[model samples]
Target: MRAPVAMKKVVISLFAILAGTSFALAADTGCDAFKWPVEREQALFPSAPAAQSGAALTVGEAVDFSLAAVDTISFEVPPGHAPAAGTFGATARVTVPPEGELQFSLSDDAWIDVVQDGKTVKSAAFSGVKNCPGIRKSLRFKLAGGAAIIQLSGAKKADLKVAVLTPE
Candidate 1:
């Protein structure tokens, strides 16, 4: 009798765990798929300063710009992925603070690269939501303290917005 009761309790516990996990997954679909909070990035997308390509950018401030044709934009270093014709791209200079990890947020779909020392700094982590209103993607990269080039390529649209932030 004791053994049967213990087995029943284990089965009930497992069932409850699975049911809770399913509910959590169902709740986080679609626009809520991001693993971390992006409220700061979302709030900064609007009213951010408008900046042109090749201009200086700063952390904690968002900048909006119009992307030029991919073939016309000169990148400090070639983008990892070669963009096809009809795609838009741009480059901007930024001095990353000594902070550990920097988050790059974009308002649209695009390939982002942070080049330091003339080489591409690999992204540590990234997240994106398709059809999500306003913001589209966010990426984190560990960059050495100093000047770095921000390369944006393969954007489907000409109008683009970007922001570099220190993750809180």
Candidate 2:
């Protein structure tokens, strides 16, 4: 068991090195898409009083992901000051192009999930990124015409970007 785990890590690490892997919306999209809006929006954390809400974002809205952990990554709260379970959450919406794939890097010690039509498609564990502090790890998901919902749980106020790629 331990051997397999170690081997898997090596395989993933190599894959990252090889596939060093968004934006905008269509006229049919419900919301307006911007050029990866970083300046337009603000960061939310698990604390700060104001950042203490689990708002299920409306699809097609211009928003970024906020994790619930120590403020070590992009949009983060302080360490030891991490929020309790369910205090932090996030969502990223992506339009599936017939058949497409989504991939992104995230922190390792984070609880991330991918949901489609309320039904969870996949889930996994990530160990912080190599050489990248705070940022978890990388994840890849393949989907069809259905909607893609990337949810970030656990980390109480961190920053994570989303991208939909490899449309076919």
Q: Pick the lDDT winner.
A: 1
| Candidate no. 2 TM-score | 0.41
lDDT of 2 by residue, 9-96 (tens): 9999988766653122233132122212221122211111221224333322333354544222332222223435545555445665
Strongest candidate by TM-score: 1
- Candidate 2 residues lying further than 4 Å off, grouped into runs, are 1-87, 107-109, 123-130, 161-168
lDDT by residue for model 1 (1-168), tens? 266988999999999999999999888876578766778877888888877789798888888988899999999888998888899999998888877478998899899999999899999999998866888898999888888999999999998899889876
Please report the TM-score between candidate 1 and the true structure.
0.82
lDDT per model vs. reference: 0.87, 0.42
- Per-model TM-score versus the true fold: 0.82, 0.41
Q: Alpha-carbon error at 67 in model 1, in Å?
A: 0.9
Model 1's alpha-carbon lDDT is: 0.87
N/CA/C clash count, model 1: 0
Residue pairs with colliding backbones in model 1 are none
